[model samples]
Target: MPVIVLEARDFSSPIFLVRTLEVISGCITFSLVASLEPPKDPSDLHPTFRIFCMFIWCFFFTLTLLIHILSIIQFHSLIPISWKNLTVTTAVLGALMGLSASVVFPWMVIDHQGSLQRPVAAAVASCITFLAYSSETCILRTQAQEQRGYMGSNPGLLKILQLWGGCNMIPLVLGVVQSQWSALGTPSGVLSWQLWVSAVLYSVCVLMSLVTLVVILGDFAGRCFLPFDRFLAGFSLIGVFLYMFATVICFTKILQLKEPGNRASAQMTELIIMETVVASITLLAYTVDLAFSIKLLCDRSHA
Candidate 1:
């Protein structure tokens, strides 16, 4: 008689491998967009739009890459939380960002029935990456619904949150309106549909941010720093930062133009750089905030 034993594979290993593939795909996408030749005609896809799209892909991909690398290296254990849960969340985020990139990269580059090869290729690559990340996330996921009640009677904290939100929203609303007006008035050199989509999304983000602040302001008896609460707070703050960034970029563009018909050529480089910097910061904030919230949730569940 002989006895045989089977060893179970580490579930986290698959998550790390999928994330690595996502990182590689993201790098490919960044390279492809970065190397794309600028359209010669002003009526074609604007270079600024391309630059913006590229920065977005770069930002998310970079964050996804870094966090997953840390997870793979077991660095996430430094936090007082379960590493598997964090890995699952990171994978989920990677999948979502991959989906966004798939659609946006192609849409941003499509113009005048020109060559769609690059965009198509990039979209396919990202789609595959998305599928991989999503599958791994599902595998590592636990049966936890992320929900939290309202905060306690903390008026001071509520006021501070409201004040901060108002400051962010005021500038953001102004910027969104300004950008929308400028694009509609001068739709020739801009991505018309993209501007419209951006306006709509920005409007929604503003409303959500304000609504979350209101939720925080309402009095209820419970711990406010719950995982889901942190999630909402973090999401609102990220929206505020993004909106402010948009405002700054729009105002800069407005300032650069000398007249109605004149375009701002010299400011493109600076604006692109600014977008990269702000996007990096926003993504980092989002990742950390989301991670903390999940960590808290996992801890509470166990307790």
Candidate 2:
């Protein structure tokens, strides 16, 4: 028979407080949104965005609950995954996803609805949940520094930002492409080329970043036969160039669309703007990651 003991430290910790807030706010956000009826207007913001927000909140809530149950039961060692890595990764991804939902839910749904009570409340809860997740992420990151995990280091932390930014860019780019496809009849000419380039850039970056994160979380970086540091450095450099090109093309397309005779709808314009902003931020993260990777490689070589 297995013995179960309650871990008092889990309940008393700062992380527990933050996670509690996360659960509360997550429940509130999804419940409020879910209570509302779907928009019938075809011109209104798509239901997909609403569904995405609800999913983010509900998924994080369930994850936090699982973590709490595991901790209470003193089952950390029974789980095969690295507990610290899992916790930190959850915090980081939760924060990023919460922030996206906070922004998107308010801007796309609440703002368009003209101050409906439930939607407004849901947006507020979403923002609160984002803050909670962000606080948890900071707490974990600070604690992680004293540990031996790769995610505690500067380059590893940058990898999280890169991963989050790539994730953010993918959806925004897809939204823009969807809008363009609807408006332009068929994918053709410069618009088609630009959309294709942006999609490929975002997809490749996301894939590489996700792979790197999985390797780190699995503690397989050292076991890999490849030169991991060099691989990171090389990919970071490539990401910088790819993001730069994609960002330029996106802005140029936006400018062309805004010319005297040509104009996109407000929603499409907003999606493009959001996509460009995410691309620019992702570019900066990659640039910084490249610098850190080089420094890390140099120090390792000297040691």
Candidate 3:
């Protein structure tokens, strides 16, 4: 049996400080939100936004606490996944999710309701948590370079961005489709093909990015028969084209919609526009990843 040892020095580390802030801020945000009375008119607010924000806070709080405990106990070494990759990945995800929750909870839930104390305070705490997570991500990324972790490399960082973009795109695309399904349907009640295509493309990209990250974390890239660099390069090249097509299709379709005459319509339109912008950014990331992957492959070939 492996003996358990406590790493006392870790408690004083900058990473630990940042993570502690994340946990504290996250706890405050969620508790404030949860303590608020239910909205007087539930329909006046979007419950999904509240639920999403709460989920993000609680999920991150729990996960970060668990990670911290594992670190203190020196239990991470017993796990199969690479600790660096896992921590960096969690930090990156927490930052992105925290940012989304910060923007969304304030705009959709807090603004929809009046400037109540708890909700407003929750939003503030959420923003602070987002900053903490962003700081942690930056710190970890810098350390990753010195540690020579795979995820700290150019391609690895690009993969993380790709994953983030894909995740945002998924929800935005689905929300638009769900809200406008009736308007997007033909006389026969069949939904627009373009809507389906956009959703499918984003989903596929997210799946691929997730699989790539898992492979890296599990240290399985070298054990696979295929050349990982070449595969990444080819996938990125294809992803660039796919995102370009999806972005154009999504933007054109959203443009065809009638101008928003109501709050709900306006919100849906905003989501669609956000999705289009994210797709464009994802396309750019894919292009950059392709370039880096090609360069890496060429260098290996010459060696």
Candidate 4:
């Protein structure tokens, strides 16, 4: 007998697939980049990191686009089509911002062997971070709230995400200032100083991002308020946060070697160990998150 199809509130399985793609791609890119030899000095910083970020940006952007397309198709057939804060417009804005950070800025802000690509990239990335992150938190908040009382959930988790957004923002803005000042003043000592500051800013923001995840995930597991499914949502965020944290930690340690000629030294070896530890934590986080996202989607569909 042919099974009859029922109207579903969500197109769960595809969302799962898309998210998995993002995670897998992000993980592969991160692992490969982490394995590379750390370079010496700020000049060496520009091209490599920029290219790496750009690749990540493009890959995620594609996934984002595909998800949206699939979403439209699914909504047309199953659930009512709705746009929360994380709408198509929001995704576009986030994508553009990410692209600027990954592709535009490094080219603009950092000089490749003494030539500038374009300085606006860093500034644009900052602006994008503020907007993208703010919108994303808003969407998460709405989702959590909607799921409230259904399976039990806490709205405060969204607040934590928002706070993390603000925290991560601080360094990005500073990074821009540092990049800009160094670009214009063209001071000899200022170059290293500003570059280091920018790195520090990004590093701090990345750390806060991870901490934010830790808080939310803590709530998800123990706080009886979160619906069983939304807990799954928290998992991916935790993983992504940790992955970012680990990668940044490795980069930050390398940035500390400012005097030149000591990038791949014994200190770097220790840093690599640290990076490995962080990566392990992140991957674990990712695994937990994948479980949550999948479970949430499945539950929501069945419910």
Candidate 5:
């Protein structure tokens, strides 16, 4: 259903409609999985229960990795750019970025069981996510710069989704780090520094997203989109949407369960959602307008 909900919009409306229907059909799938475990009674449950919850959590996380890989392929298909006949480097980086998380989960959860290996694995994954995204963003900026004088229709939607999708991983990285910042109920978990560091880091991710959106919008407005291009605007807009949506989902889930341990988590969640929702939704509207404009550009070219 998560796959279908997102897949519905990538291309033809009929295809999207089919995906939407499929998503609806899978409501039972989500509910069934969610209902499997008894609700956590925060006061009574041992910390081990959270580990059990995390084990079940891997299935959904795997789906996200799948989505990231799919977005990479789809975005690559949209771009005219390439690497030795391969599509944009962005796609390649995205594939690696997705793998980072996929690998981290099994290594930390199944193989090592929160032993020394877990933190080591997570730190490696964090570095991979960060490097992949930053490298991909640099590639995109280069692509736009190379096409500086050659104006055509804005970059295709695929490129937009790919690039921004890669760029959005920083927030994912932060949230993941925060979630497993330490081995809970232990000295590491009790440490104030870890929570404060994560709070600050995630907060930075949120601010970076806002900056990215603003820059993308300004590019469309000022018509300076050479590297990332105006079409990247839609990608940026979608990135913002996913960022905000994920932020909200995380906050709501944590709060509903009353498990966002530190005061920082609660305060940061509120701050992020409030600002991100307003900015992202507005940019989304602008992106739709730009998409229609792209159609006009295509029509004129055909004419």
Candidate 6:
């Protein structure tokens, strides 16, 4: 008889340590949000913002916690794990945490009402948290690429994800620019030229997603190096949903901005909703797609 012994090694991975810190940061932010008093002024701030912030914080906290637990299991040799999938998840978490750092400011405003200290500290902590996760992602990715020839399932889907990811940056960058320079004040309503710009950008995002879905599906057999599975379809659908929702939100915000009596507080609320929804969905879609692809790669490696 032959004996085979498998020892778990995930805890020794540097990525595991980074994920632990990320979870801690999420918990700190979540606790702070929970302890804050309810919004005093309904007109200036809505309860929904606080509720949304809490939801996001909780989501991040729970996700990291679960991932950490799974890592521990894999480390103990209780189960096998895919390093590539974990790396993708970490990369996605880094993106979401970066967005979380930005998202905290609005909640800070509602919670602290002009105090700079608490919000700044939280934001800095969140930023550092993302940086740590990002560092881990880079390290894992470098290691993977060194061990494996390339990181993706096939050249085709990899190209699509790369292009799609790059295109997404367009909206992200433009939104940042618009927010920073928004005080210059553009025209409102359908007459708002900036509104048209937003409309066009989001429209492109939608069109691109749609086109990607069709192209990937129509020729999936020929193009995919891996099996054409439901995961690919699900991932493509998420992309489409993300772009469609973003397009609708862009138009809605334009209309809201044109409203005669719309308060600045209301505008800020709308912005928060839009940014949070878009960022969350985008991060989720990317994470799932990469995770599935990585799973396939892991299967190959195991085989």
Cα displacement (angstroms), candidate 5, residue 302, comes to: 8.5
Model 3 C-alpha lDDT per residue in residues 1-303, reported as the tens digit of each score: 676756777678898899999999999999999887666753333665677788889998999998888877778888999888888878888898899889888777876656588888999999999999999988877773746377777787788888888877755765676566434443122236777788788888888898888888898889867888877887798788889889888677566655464333666778777878788888888999999988899899899
TM-score of each: 0.47, 0.90, 0.87, 0.32, 0.28, 0.51
**Global fold similarity of model 3 (TM-score):** 0.87
Better candidate by TM-score, 2 or 3: 2
Clashes of each: 0, 0, 0, 12, 3, 0
What ordering of candidates by lDDT runs from best to worst? 2, 3, 6, 1, 4, 5
State the C-alpha lDDT per candidate. 0.51, 0.80, 0.80, 0.43, 0.39, 0.52
lDDT for model 4 comes to: 0.43
Judge candidate 1 against the unseen true structure and give its global Cα lDDT, from 0 to 1: 0.51
- Looking at model 3, residue 90 earns an lDDT score of 82
As a TM-score, model 5 comes out at 0.28
Per-residue CA lDDT of model 1 for 102-194, tens digit only, reads: 654565465522667776676677677778777765655533432111221222223223333332333233333344445455554454543
Which candidate number has the best TM-score? 2
Error of 3 at 138 (Å): 2.3
Candidate 2, residues 231-303: lDDT per residue as tens digits? 8888899989998998898789779876886546677898888888888888888999999889989999999
> Residue by residue across 1-303, what tens digits does model 4's lDDT show?
333332364435443344444444444433433344344455333443455454544555464555556554544233232333233323333433453344333443244324222233333433444344344434444455443222113223322333333333343333433443444454346445644553554455356545434443333335546664465466456545645654565465446555565434442344244434434444454555456567668877999
Distance from true location, Cα of 165 in model 3, Å: 1.1
How many clashes would you count in candidate 5? 3
- Model 4: runs farther than 4 Å from truth? 1-43, 75-119, 122-126, 144-303
TM accuracy, model 4: 0.32
Instruction: Output the TM-score of candidate 2.
Output: 0.90
TM-score of 1: 0.47
**Is candidate 1 or 5 superior in lDDT?**
1
Question: Which 10 successive residues of model 2 have the least lDDT summed?
Answer: 144-153
Looking at candidate 4, the ten consecutive residues that score lowest on lDDT are 148-157
